[model samples]
Target chain A: MEYAYYPGCSLEYSGKPYDKSIREVFKALGVKLRDIKDWNCCGATMYVSIDKIVACSVAARNLALAQNMGCDICAPCNSCYTILRKVNRYLAYDPEMRGKILEVLKAANLTYDTPVDVRHPLDILVNDVGLDTIKEAAPYRFDGLKVAPYYGCQLVRPEHHFDDVDDPMTMDNLLTALGADVVPFASKVRCCGGSLMTTCEEVALDLNNSILKDAEDNGAEIMVTACALCQMNLEGYQKKINKRYSQKHNMPIVFFSQLIGLALGVNPKRLGLQSMLVKPKNLKLIPKGMKVEA
Target chain B: MPSIPPIPEPKRQREADLREAFLKEVAGIPAGEKIKNCIQCGTCTATCPVSRWMDITPRETVALFRAGMLEEILESRTIWICASCYSCTVRCPMGIQVTDLLYALKRLATDKKIYPSRFPAHALSDTFISSLYRFGRIYELELGLRYFLKTHPLKLLANIGFGLLMIIKGRMAILPKRIKKANEVKAIINRAKELEGV
Candidate 1:
């Protein structure tokens, strides 16, 4: 299957591992991800909070570009996925919003006729690609590696299009299919407080602390997530959370795509494993002598 | 975090226009007006991860909003503290768009220029938009530096080591990768702003 891939800004930068692994994993599965040329930001959560019309109009620009590719667009970032989906929802339901976005697009000399479907990598892998396909395609296994699936908030909540919001099993099921010991994490669908890590440090820290504490308490050796912000917040500020809460949280947070890549026997460097702040101490390589972690 | 002022007591005639504006805009959000169905069950507040940081609970924000106390809701730290996790939105018994309403409230407060003084979250939004307009994509390093400089310079100084580490690890770019159609993107945004202003 082919998709117009829109890697939101975070994936292009701090979330590079997510972007890299997503591309590599899809390639291994023989799926095509065509980059949406000249795609800009999806306006993220900040844009909607400031100006909804402006945000939708900006997001519409990306959709218009993706439509040029004549296929549904796949966005890896949870925020981008949600924002793009939201704009589509608004376009279909809210005529006023639709009219304004159209007007703005018209001024830019662009037109978006068909609304494109924005799919997450998880949805594509577990649902569309199917576990059976992955089972055959994947040559390696987690070998009972302990993992906690952190869905973050945006992927499943506010809309239950693909997975259950509170008790999502898409990632858990996918990991199990890859031979990992999927740990039961109660706060799996919890918030990471996103940019508040920089904005409101203490409050954001508290939120991250609880998430990390749960994963650790659940006996997870590492945490895997789909959202860029979730990975960044949980992994980067883990040091601060440990300092403040005085709890030892050394679990490595990596993208689900990265873990999938490893299980598929893709090169660890290609998956950006070395970029993690906290190294994956418990990860074991399938072929032996190739593990990047401690 | 900026210190939120004490919640305002209702001054009826003086703030009717504010309430009307909030209601009209909020009505446009999907199931947004279902806030009227809120039974003050505190489900939203209970679901919120950072509700303790909020001056007004999510349920109370709706109660005050439905009671036409727009100023009090606006003045509270509740909206800013909302990470927009949507845990409350999906779990609300009345199907209220609790988180979406909070987004609307944030925009309204920003438009009126009346949020708590020096609110850092506002700086984050400001820096993100400015970066988006300039390069058509967010430059993470620059966004973080600008955000800290605007909101907390001392923290920026403290994190210099970590910043360098990020760059060395190739996780962050030293310079932004500009989109070829930045001008085109800017034109769309500018036009949208003008059209919305009307």
Candidate 2:
């Protein structure tokens, strides 16, 4: 499978592990990901609230750039995916808005025929790569692992397309294919409080703590998320809370791709395991040179 | 020696800071101009989730801004209660970006030490900032435990069982991870902080 991957701003700056693991896992699976050429931030989290027209125009510029590249757009970040998908859906469904958007895009010397498909990485892997293909590539089975697959807020919310937004099974199915156990939890659809962490920390943290508490309470060994911000809010913030409270939670977080990389018997170093904040001691079922520090 | 009570904010001075800081913080909002053109429409207030929780309405928030009554508005706990749902943004007839302005107010309040409490929100913000600073990214395990330790230290024992289980399962690694280009990340964060005047 080939895709024009859009990691967005967060992935480029703070989501390096997600970026590395995603590329590594995809490569191991014989999939090719070409990042969108000269892309800019998709004004979803704040711009949309600050200015609607400018936000839509920012998103439109990226979409037009992807469409020009002549391939489907695959966004790994949930906010990026939501903005692109929302804008594309609007352009397709609303002709008047489409005309207005085109007028705005004219300044950038671009026009939208809606050239490329906008998909999340999960949709590409499950829908295009197929489970059977993934199963064949698994060198190690996750027979004993119980993973809590968290989709966060953006992947399936606001509109239904690809899978059930309320409760997604794609990640669960993908993990099961790798031979890992899936811990069913209700916090999957819960919001990570969005960019409230930037503007309002209390609400965002409480919401994050609640979700983490629920995931831990539900017996999830770890939380696997596709959204980079969700991963950051859930994983990166845990240690500060731990140190202040004089506690520790060894619940390591991994991108879906990194786990797949482990299942496929790839080198742990190549999968960017060292980039994780909550480091897990026991990495996988494989007896490879995968380092585990307790 | 007598223990000092929490310092009370001077009403007039707080009001002035609230007005000036709010305007400075929300300066980037495109809808800021339209906010002054508001015709007393209740559309934004009707759509706000925090409306029922606080005395200040969304329209009233903008009204306060127009009247230079920002200090009283800031003193209220209502700023912390907004969810930033964008529902008000979508409904405003005057196209005022109430949600974005709310964020500006929060940034100002937090930076100026105007917060009401540290039990939940302030502590969470500290963690959020630390996570980004520690690892150029998010780590779920760290975030959860940190919240427990800071907000409810007594609950620390609860996560020990899971922590041990994770270790036994070979899923948890104890060593902290760092970016290969740590200084580059530090620079980025510094730049953002400088932009926010922090």
Candidate 3:
């Protein structure tokens, strides 16, 4: 399968590992990912909160570009996925908003002919490329590594067209297929308090602390998430959370793509494993240069 | 002890004009009309992760909007503190789209310039949007510098250690990656502003 990939700003900066692992895993699975040329920011919640019309127009520009490519766009970041999908839905449903957005697009010499399906990489992996195919591509299994599959809030909430909002199963199913022990984590679909870390440290840290405590209590050696912001908040702010809560929770947070890439026997460095703030100690399970004994 | 005499009622009554004006303003924005459908249920507050920190909970924010207490709600930090996680929207029993309602409140606050001056979120959002406008993409370095300078210059000094570590790890790029036709993006933004009558 082929897709037009839209790696938003986060993937290029703080979320590089996700971008790297996404590319590596797709290559291993014989899938083609074409970059959406000259793509800009997806306006995230920040832009939308400041100005809804401009945010929608900016997102519409991306869809117009993807429509030109004639392939669905796959966004790895949950924020990007949520915003792009929102613009698509709004332009289709609200005629007044559509008229305003189209006027802006016309000035820029762009047109969104039809609504392009905005997909998350997890959706593509499970729905487009079957789990069996992923299993077959993996030359090695995880050796029963315990993982807490965190979906965060954006991917499944508000408009849960693809998965159940309350109880998502795609991440769990995918991880299980890769031979990892998927924990029945209760905070799987909870909010990670994205961007609040900058504005309100106390609240953001408290919410993140709860998520970590739950994952660790569930016996998860590592927490894998599909959203970049969730990974950053949970992993990057571990020390601050520890200091605030007076608890030592050193669980490593990694991207779901990184876990899949490891199972597919792809090189660890290619997946940007070393860049993780908290390294997964169980990474020793997959030894260096180890190959499947076919 | 002798009982005190009953106090007389005040002569003047506060007009409901504030509520009427707020309702009219919200009606002009997309999805803002749904605020009228609120059922006063507290599910939104219960599901909110940071409701404890907010002065007015999501449920109460809607209630305040319904009651036409716009000035009080605007003065509170509840709207700015919302993380836009959408948990409340998903669990809202009335299907009121509480998160978008909060966003509408934020936009209203920003328009009236009613938010706190030293609000870090406002600085961050302004820096992010301005960076996007200038370069057609977010320049992390530029955004970081601008946000720190505007909100907390001393915090920038404290965060230097972490910033250096990220740079060493190749996590942050000093320069932004610009789009090919950035002028076109600027045109789109300008046209959008005109379209919105901003």
Q: Highest lDDT, which number?
A: 1
After superposing candidate 1 on the true structure, give the runs of residues whose Cα lies further than 4 Å from its correct spot: A287-294, B1-13
lDDT of 2 by residue, A1-294 (tens): 588888875665356667777888788878888877656556555444333444466577678878866678889888888889878765765566566667666655667775567898888889998999888877777765778888876687544668775578999999888767788788777667665554455556666777777778878787888888888778866765565445465677778888887888777777767667678555557443344343
lDDT of model 2 at position A272: 68
* Per-residue lDDT of model 3, residues B1-198, tens digit only: 999974333311221444554555466455667777788879888988888888888888877765556766877888888888788887876667788877777776676666754555666788889988888888877777888888878877866787777788778888888888888788998999998788
Best by DockQ: 1
lDDT of 3 by residue, A117-201 (tens): 9999999999999899998877777756889999999999778778999899999999888767888799998888898877767
TM-score for each candidate, following the candidate numbering: 0.95, 0.63, 0.93
- The per-prediction tally of clashing pairs is 0, 29, 0
Give me the overall lDDT of model 3: 0.83
Clashing pairs in 1: none
Worst 10 residues of 3 chain A by lDDT: A285-294
Candidate 2 structure quality by residue, lDDT tens digits, B1-198? 999985355766776766675665454444455666778888877865446655577778777777766765666666766655455665677777676677667666655666654424445556644654556343435755786687776656755775555445433445444544434344434443333334
After superposing candidate 3, which stretches have Cα over 4 Å from the reference? Answer: A284-294, B1-32
How high is the CA lDDT of each candidate model?
Answer: 0.88, 0.67, 0.83
DockQ of each: 0.73, 0.05, 0.63
Task: Show pairs that collide, candidate 3.
Answer: none
